[model samples]
Target: MSTNDDGIEYVYTRFITRNGKRIYHQKGGLYKFPKRSKKSKS
Candidate 1:
């Protein structure tokens, strides 16, 4: 996981296949989804 100066957060996950092959998955972009706040008003 990482974040840039522009506050753009990036996340990546690595997976190993049964054949010993590596796969990478990534998400996040300039238009990433908004994060939910933990503090909610009743």
Candidate 2:
């Protein structure tokens, strides 16, 4: 979902919840989607 939206489909490992926000996890560390949308603008 977020992975594909954020354009990190391959590198994405999984996602987590912290501070009421979705935190994506990868091999390097973690990150949050720049902006959430029902449909990605790009």
Predicted model with the maximum TM-score: 2
Per-residue lDDT for 1-42 in model 2, tens only?
A: 336545443333476666999766565444444444355565
Most lDDT-accurate candidate? 2
Model 1: residues with Cα > 4 Å off, grouped in runs: 13-42
**Can you list the residue pairs that collide in candidate 2?**
none
Q: Count clashing pairs, candidate 1.
A: 0
Question: What is the per-residue lDDT of model 1 for residues 1-42, given as tens digits with 9 covering 90 to 100?
Answer: 554444444444444233577544465233332333343334
Displacement of residue 20 (Cα, Å) in model 2 is 0.5
Residue 37's lDDT within candidate 1 is 36
For each candidate in turn, give its C-alpha RMSD to the true structure in angstroms: 9.4, 7.4
